[model samples]
Target: MSKPLRVVVWSTGWIGSIAVEAVHRRPDMELVGVWVHSAEKVGHDVGEIVGIGTVGVVATSDADALIALRPDCVVYAASGPERDTAAVPDYVRLLEAGINVVTTTSTRLVYPPTFTAQWRDALETAAKAGGTSLYASGIFPGFGSDQLALVLSTQSSTIQKIEATEVSLNDHYPVADVMMDGMGFGRPLDFAPWLSRPGTIEASWAGPIHLVAEGLGAVVEEVRGSLERALADRDIEVAFGMIPAGTVGAVCTRAVGVVDGREAIVIKHIIRMARDVAPDWLGSECDATYRVDIDGDPDIHCTMTMGEMQGHAAGRGAMVATAMRVLNAVPYVVDAPAGLLSSLDLPLTLPRFALRTAHR
Candidate 1:
């Protein structure tokens, strides 16, 4: 029988914590190490940090320790709303050291072909040098933008344009920094959110747009981005904190790809702290929905709605779904060719395990 793959869980944030739990539970994977960024998390059992009890694996902040352990794969879940410049070098170091990586961070790394020449060349070179691979995926850019679009395009006879939309309620999400600093939620309307900064949305979302274009046998000439926000009419309280009246309550953003001076591919986000905040914008038929519309000869449209799973909080369910998307890709990525990859390059990653049932 083949041995379990050795894995290191990097970070313990929203997705990272879930990664630790997933790795611990997988029979085909072994939890060998945990690397953390927070000083307070140092020297604690990873199982305890992720609320899975003690698994006897201590979390460390030392990169050298991780290198010494020689893990086969690292689940990179570190979050950086401002695009921490150091993350690229960190991945470069890990790849050069011969460790494969599957991450939910760095959306630009999701589709290597769309990335800048310097960044793409560096990562590809590192992977070739180490004979390992790197894969980046998540709920939106990973599944909604690239995977979903491709799946829906099978019905299109002559595709003219495609738009992928994500409408999610952020009230249940517990990340304060993501809601406040990154999204500008609860801030005054005039304040620019992190995503609204120049070139931020384009850099982060264009990869997926290009991936869709490539899948449809077309090329996106230019990708443009735009953002708009709505102010709250009354104070509202959510999981993280309270939002005062007149603050930003909802945001709608889009990254549109132009082919031949016409919009051919688009990614749209409609995020609201409260369901009532953005009445004019698109609302999900369910609690949260990922909708992909293909405007073409056949005109295909598909939607995915995720609600409470086994009575857990809605936001927590979303987080787990995102983690699963990354986790299920592990085996396929390990066996794939050594290079930076996109969803299009991999086979369908289906979950091998089933949910526990009450029946004995």
Candidate 2:
């Protein structure tokens, strides 16, 4: 048998660490190195940084040193307050070196089209010039927004409209600060701010909506957003931290891309904490639900509901699933088109064990 693919894991954050675990368990992949942003973590064993046993790999922040290793691929899971500025450059550098790349950045949804147009073009050019490939995808807008929408289209003949909805209890927050502050949890919030804001949650999903609309052979003229918040008066305990009960901590946002004032594609996101007691539209026990509505010949509708108890598991599953997808595509990306490619454009096939293992 041929030697396993050598992969460099850049970043040890939440998703990065999980991707490390996923890579280690795969028989076809080998972990060769790790990259981190913290100086304190430098020189430490990669296994310890990921909470696994020693694997002989040491963590370093030196990009030049990492590039010198000549890894076959780079799984980038770096998180930061400044992701667009700092993290993106790292991935681009790797791509420029002709190394395959897969990332979980939310901004990745707009590749080659909306956001990072120049960078996307550059990466595509580099990948093509170096015979490498690069792809980006995640669970929310990545899977549910793009892939699932594409799947729903298969059920339609003359598709007219498509709608995707996601609802979750706030318990899915991985980091307390981001959940409580970045999301404005535990505060008397106004939904208007997020809807009217240029770069808020509503705006973030626009990329996926546009992607789906274009894929469905429709041109979206305008987009509209609506949001609701759940408030409590007391505090509730959660794995991340305590969120004030009865405070405006949970938010439900719905954005619709319109063609002639009719909804073509709808993206819905609901995030809530333990204090949220509001009844779900479908009445599932504090779980997350994804529903796709397709108006076509047969009127296709597909729904997936994940139990609330599996929120953490699902988040981890998303990380693993996305990583495995990237890992599986590395070989083909070497000869793919010369431009930013989304999950839709890349040649991706789910690994058989990925779903079974992630569900566990």
Listing every candidate in turn, what is its Cα RMSD in Å to the true structure after a full C-alpha superposition?
Answer: 2.6, 3.5
Top candidate by lDDT: 1
lDDT of 1 at 214: 85
TM-score of each: 0.92, 0.85
Clashing pairs in 1: none
Model 2 weakest 10-residue run by lDDT? 351-360
> Mind giving the per-residue lDDT tens digits that candidate 1 earns over 234-302?
998988798888998998889999998999999998998877887999886445678999889998888
Q: What clash count goes with each model?
A: 0, 11
Q: What lDDT score goes with residue 47 in model 2?
A: 82
Model 2, 234-317: lDDT tens per residue?
776656767676566566778888886788788887765652355444333435666777877888888876543443443454
